[model samples]
Target: MIARRPEGADMEAKLFGSRLSPFVEKVARALQLKGIAFTLVPPKSPADFKRWNAQTRKMPVVEIDGRRVFDSTLILRRLDQLVPEPPLLDRDAGIAARQRFLEDWSDESLYWYAMALRWSDANAEATTTQVLGSIPAPAALRPVLRVVLRRQLRNQALAQGLARLPLETVVDELGRRFDELLVWLGDRPYFFADRPSVADLALFGQLNVLQSGPTPQAERLVAERPRLADYFLRVDAATAERRAEPGRGAARGVDFGTTARGA
Candidate 1:
């Protein structure tokens, strides 16, 4: 692989979503790692959701030049197209296929597990507050938004089939998934590669949210696995540097190097 170089410094890319969302973080990390400088367009109200992405209303939407794109996977693909250096997908067909599967698993499977835990009874209040904190709603409306958001997300998690299970079961199953992730990761610095890829970014996004201050039960799950925790940090170091602009374009990343999972 060629030495990775940042490109599209002048690219006018704007990401729409709350950084707290794992899906948003997935795309944000991809942009930073790709060396693409972009603005993060945080939602001004709940209305921005449908406004930015009328099709799904879910976020981490990317607007390049003028074309808007939603979904984390598609956003990463767009990044690769814009800056092909240090590809997010491998050149080898087999490896790329494995990476793609892992990426989907992280997004489609692990994501729900993380979400189920986040919206679980034990963590709902904390999750609600953390999410509402970023929404810029009026003070009086916070309580109303809190109830609506919590109910809506919990319903979605229930519909997905994981939130119905007991929190302990969710935590246990998530641990097993983490174990399999380590197995797939083996001794590589990043998942299936010496460099970061969509797979690593996807996994990082889920793990990032699980430990991002709202889910202590899930955080403890990661705390038990030193390798998985370290892997999270390595991926962060690789991708989160340039966009590390605190309240700016960069979404905050958990630095396990400083903050332990349970800390």
Candidate 2:
């Protein structure tokens, strides 16, 4: 069983999530940006699954001061409310709306593209091998487990239209959207404002996943938009610093290293 710090104990927060999920990363980045103390508990088994579902019925559940917060967007808003100094949401209504639109697009629209990529035959096989290799399952059972996982993933892909759509079509769509984002940003350092806002955090988390992977278009976009890439790096470093501090508050950062398997 994964060890959980006492909920609502002092200033510490605990997050249950998978590393590969951009939504989880969004919440983690927000906590890091705000210098909040938290523990990252990776759910590695069916038992861990039950524990997480009992709390929020979803992954990326945030336990702050013993209160549980679910949904990545809501978590960002909560962080903004908690730390008003550096607001993640813009003050202007129009800009905030635009920012939110982009964030929503990333979460709802772009997510399918990522799903398509992850569930591709080659990617699925690679991920299955990686996941099974990490667990302590008996060597004899590994192949059986792998087949089950692959079939399950295939079912999911079909349900999500991932298996039906051509990868090129998905990639082209993503590339086009990314190009639009670049053009929209123009010369600005961030998406909608001079400072990094919730919108920036949301989009950055999603795009960062792509950039870190084998997506050539994602890499090109990052290279073209160096400022955005730099922004992500800064956020990551800040998050690490906040998590590395001493005492209860020091526990705020989620260690991506430990949860890297989810990625």
Candidate 3:
């Protein structure tokens, strides 16, 4: 449940998650776009999985004004209600509908494709290594964590149905999704609007993962489309700190003076 906001008061937000998660990336970019300053906290140990977010036991959980928000989609929706400027959705009904659809597609469908690629036989080892490298854990724990983490992720993909397909089939189908996006984007600077919407942020998160190591094939596939590449740069620039506009009021709601730090 979301905490009630003090009317017209400044608030602060604490986002507990690793940047490796596209969902986390999407929320981080959304906060940046809204000019909400937040710390990008990486889980210090395996236990943080349940502690940080007991509901889903997932990263990307956010805390503000005694409110804890789980799930990226809900966070974005709550953000739009709290901070109205540079809205995440267009004012036009038709435009907003399309933007919402694209955002959902990015999170639900595109995410699984990337996950399948990550846990595929070819990239699985590299992906495991990267996951271990990103974790802030004790040196002694790395060995055990590697085996456990790999199994958990691979199992997730396997159950999701995409990972069960042949590697070549997954790659080809993913490329086709990119083609569909190009058709949807057409010549627009942003999806359904001149400014970056939740859709753009969502797409950016998935694309960023594709380009960032562990999936060279996915990276190359993204690079194959120059327009899509430019979209990446544009989205990155728009939500970056330099482009972030100071919120009209504030997000200094959370008092992190005594929050735990594993590092």
lDDT of each: 0.80, 0.65, 0.80
Q: TM-score: which is higher, 2 or 3?
A: 3
Which scores higher on lDDT, 2 or 3? Answer: 3
Runs in model 3 with CA error above 4 Å? 1-10, 243-263
Per-residue lDDT over 81-103 for candidate 3, one digit per residue giving the tens place of the 0 to 100 score: 88776689999999999999999
Deviation (Å) of 242 in candidate 1: 1.8
User: If scored against the real structure, what TM-score would every candidate get?
Assistant: 0.90, 0.79, 0.88
**Candidate 1 C-alpha error for residue 9, in Å:** 2.4
When sorted by lDDT, best at the front, the candidate numbers are: 3, 1, 2
Error of 3 at 222 (Å): 1.1
Q: Residue 65 deviation, candidate 1, in Å?
A: 3.0
Over all chains combined, what TM-score does candidate 3 have?
0.88
Model 3 residue 153 distance off true place after TM-score fit, in angstroms? 0.4
lDDT of 2 at 113: 71
Pairs that collide in candidate 2 are 8-65, 8-66, 20-262, 20-263, 37-252, 38-251, 38-252, 88-198
Candidate 1 regions off by >4 Å? 1-5, 243-263
